[model samples]
Target: MPHLPDSVHVMTDDTRPHTATPTTEGVWSVRGTRITADRTPEGLRLRARAGAEGLSRIVLRWRLDTPEDARILGDAWERGYGDLQWRTLQPDRALPWYALITGGAFGGPTTGWGVRTRPGALCSWTVDESGIALWADVRSGSLPVLPGEREVDVATVVTAAGPTPFAAHEALCTAMSPDPLPAVGPLVGCNNWYYAYGRDFGPDAVLRDARTVVEYADGHPVRPYCVIDDGWTEGGGSAPGGPWDTGLPGVFDDMADLAARIAETGARPGLWFRPLLSRTETAAVRPGLLRDSGFPLDPSLDVALETVAEDVTRFRNWGYGLIKHDFSTYDVFGRFASHSPAELALPGWSLSDRSRTSAEILVRLYGTIAEAAGDAVVIGCNTVGHLSAGLVRVQRCGDDTSGRSWERTRRMGVNTLAFRLAQHDRFFTLDADCVPCTPRTDWRLNRRFLDLVARSGTALFVSVDPAARTDRTDADLAAAVRLALDGGTPGGVEPLDRLSTTAPRRWRSGAETLVHDWAEPWGAVPLAV
Candidate 1:
């Protein structure tokens, strides 16, 4: 039997309800707005048409049939968002994109509900004893949609019942993202961000890092990557905004030369840039192309998009094989997923073009980047996974891990890796951020993380600070890099204790069940910096 929603609700402006009249079996209308729910083999497809009054949200309610004591697991908004674990039902907690229910009446099988990420609206779910409510936020920023009567793709809802929660979640992910971009070989690399933090790094420092990663690879057939993260562009140092057209005047005189030097050391050269941000006040970057009187370039503007495309093309022309674009979600919406509310973006500020939703604008921006990147592997940092699935080859699934603090890594890195691991390859090559081997962090814990990431067969990146490298650390990193280049372990990895803990301690690989202690002698500290 097909599982259909019991009722449909529409909201405009705030939470003020608009009457939705059922027109047909799977269709509803509100004022001039129309919503269609089409049943598919895997699940249901939801699309909506906005009326002149504009549309804010389209909610579908499904009656709950499972036991009350079932455990539920939910996903995050984008990379760098965490706090994911299986827990008792929280009626008002927003589960972004998907939610999974297990235990209770369903002994072994798990029931999963997920909305496809590739939609014009941000999708979330709220579950209570009576039922489940899937909320499609179609608002243009905080305001109601004024896009006229044009049809907008809301979201696709997929449900699965499999033997285990992992299996069920995997099935739902596969159904949600049908066409993910293929990864370019083994994605083992060294990123300098955690250690360097986009400061005091010149061409020589970058080449030293490249040589370190290549040395670690030890002549593996698959070349490792050396990404020169941040700091390479004009107005150098840890400043967030950019004028990405040229290298820093004295530090990085020629980016093309730097790329060639990195490639000469037998490592693939990668570059990082903040495309939607610019410090350069030029005629091309007009006030109309900005959301506020600030640095963030409004992606809704054609001029801003042209600027991004030109920057990407320039990077590709520099002979960089991989391009890691960061902070688009933040630049677009003015906040990170962790800081924003369940609505994803703060209210009170709409885009320059109010006709399109935030999701639609982001999709356009990602498509623009992908097109300009051409043959280069695109790694989206701080980009929405659903919108970038088919466009980017890799998605940073978690928030930044720390070189300064271990608790931050345990909180953000471990939690996201254990929970979002199901989305690996199904959406894009999941990057749980880099494992930082620095003086401030413990090598023992970092080594364990390195082993797991390499074995998982996802993107494995390490930030190896020169001061932190010892004989033991060098041996461990070399082994992990070689293993990752060979495509991790054959059977892949699975988190065994994901339901009980945010940072799972137990994981299964092939026939072996491995366990590691993430805690220090003093236990977990507050996640600071």
Candidate 2:
């Protein structure tokens, strides 16, 4: 039988915990707030009503029945949120979305617990030997829920047990994300960011990339993509902010024409932009449209949303088939996913509109982008995976893979792909950044990564520098691109050593088992650079 939560508590702005009193079979109340838990086959659907005393968190507690020495696996807040591996349970660690427990033996049977919602609140888990707790963070930045707010549709808590950790995790992911917008075709592509870093490049360079990927594709039915990342806009470079109205003055004039030219190379054109930021003033700027100063537009405002929608519409209109929208999560929250719950957001500031929670605001922002994108494939980067699941066709599941450092690729790319691979197609097509072919990094290490991504049947994007291309590199690139375009191996890939390492070296691809060496001559760098 499944274990239900034993108690529910609310944490208000005063830092006091309020235990909810049972009012009905599946309902409870605290002061003026009402909490309801509806049992469904998937899990328990939790909802709440806020009172005059605002709430910061709604916690659900369950007593543990498992062995004392169980290992746990949790998730991250977004892409670039690394350090995913099964470890000894940490009571205070914030595990986003779900947590899986094993009996401390390698390849042992596993049990998983997770949350399912549109994510009206940011849900996380904390586990100890005696009990486990799930935290539903409903705070608007650092502020609590004030008076006269709408009801919060918290999250559904689900559980599953399986013969293996992979099976259990896959089941949990399917339960959590019931509806996902899957990619239309194999997402084999080339992006310029890793190689070019979005500087000293223009339409000519972009076309060269398009032609190269097409050449590598060798006329596969699933046409590859050539994405112009971050440098095309005026006043944009490596660390690009927006004012995305026009292309760079002389270098990338005629955006529509460039898109057409990219298509002429027999590759679909994709573009990247930071939608919530701008370098110059625009119609989106108003008193309530900004969180502070300097251009992170408040997504809660209608005008700001309108401006974002307009930018997306413009990208689609420019004849691009794919749009990679990035960095809104950092812009909205003023930080990356590298924060603890206590430091999730900057303190003492709320959204312009206080009627809704932060999760609701982010959902609305993603929805606006999706609706505006029309037929174009939408890829979300630096966006919350749990919230953006059903909206985006693709999601960058890890932090950036580096061209300059093999350590970054091993730590960020291999770790994220190995751990988050279960979310492929269940949430969105998982993109573990790029396979960067550059002079700075070894081809030996990168080719292994390239092969794994292609065989995994996930979105495979390679960034090839002009100087790095050789006869051998070209041959390898061709094989990987073709395999990726053909939808990988028949049964898809599975990590064999996930329970033991962050970067699994053994994989089961179709009927074949393959092993890879991800280490370099000096071994992995001590830090994730």
Candidate 3:
């Protein structure tokens, strides 16, 4: 047997003195939970469960022999969609291989943390780290386990083994995902938010973009898509509920017709909306619980869930083939990107229904959207990645990349693609975000970012501004579209420098190795006309 790290079980309930004794092969009985773990041919199989005492959290911590110089990598709780504070942990001040809990706080579940050693290892947790610590579920507030509950089944947390970090993550995601990977082809398309910024865009603007997609397609076997983001709302503004109508009167005029028009351009039509936040008009008709903002519908209520399903169903009926729902995590927790999942736990507050765990609530909500969406592909943004895993067909895995700042694009876009790229089809088709081709950004940098997106095998969304039409005309964009639609290089591309830098300059896509210095600005951003 290969030498293995000794597993040390750490539990919150220290007062109750307990002894762990190896009772069966690769299994130990500690406190009320069974600690079963072993090095398998694939990797390590680790699980903790309690049938009588009702398990909460059981962390199997292992220590490094030297702790001399150690580095750790922990994934962001949700993709960078909130306050824009959460960063990939590359602790500035080096520690003796031990770092503070950068993952979920003491009250929640930390999905996985790994040392910079190989074969690369990745751990996936069943419960949110928060629940095990403070008894607060990720979505729902802390709820005490009822007495005499039959059993507490904490999901299996697999510490996957692989020759590289990317491979380990791929396996970890595969182990964690509940739904089978979808047989989705390349979703190379254009989104309006980067250029429109939710300010002004309607039927004509969307149709024009859709036409660009068709022109860019250039007779590709796989069709392109045009997504009308944000500004299409009726009486646009944030409030709860909706007439849920499409576009303000005279803007899109008729949504069903608008969708047909985009399809006529040989492109699929997609729409982006904050499902929980609604206009005042929507609020009046289907009033339900409200979040801290006093406008966004509280997802904790049953009635609000019904409203959500109804609204999503309306979009499907309107002929939109894809629906991107954003900001539900922020709405439910009243916390944005700044707070980790652990920080969002509020023990005093309970949902309208306390029976369901936070994870359960989110699953139910996402599942509702999926069920109502019918055939329309659903993309979840500002959602918890672990919870959104199987529910959404596509997930915006990182924060928004900037059209105005090259640094922001590199930090947000390239970093996410490099680190979370392993989740490409496992959780959902990971979307690092659109390649913003606007005059405000440096095209040289944006073009490299676009190439990465096209070849990353993730969802490719290009937000082309009218001013940057020439920039989008570059042959690279079309070639990238071809590569993306063809499902990218086989053996799944991996970022070679993910652990070394926040923005990796090196990537290996099967046979070809691609390199780009994102920090090297090709030229200054052209002054806006």
Model 3 is weakest, by summed lDDT over 10 consecutive residues, at 117-126
Tens-digit per-residue lDDT, 131-217, candidate 3: 211111222344423224333322333333344455555655565554644846888899988888766677778888988877787
Rank list by TM-score: 1, 2, 3
Off by over 4 Å in 1: 104-108, 282-294
User: Clash pairs of candidate 2?
Assistant: 80-399
How many residue pairs in model 2 have overlapping backbones? 1
lDDT of every model, 2 decimals: 0.84, 0.85, 0.62
| Candidate numbers, best lDDT first, in rank order | 2, 1, 3
lDDT of 3: 0.62
Off-target runs (Cα >4 Å) in candidate 2 are 1-4, 14-16, 104-108, 147-149, 282-293, 339-343
Residue pairs of candidate 1 with colliding backbone atoms: 80-398, 80-399
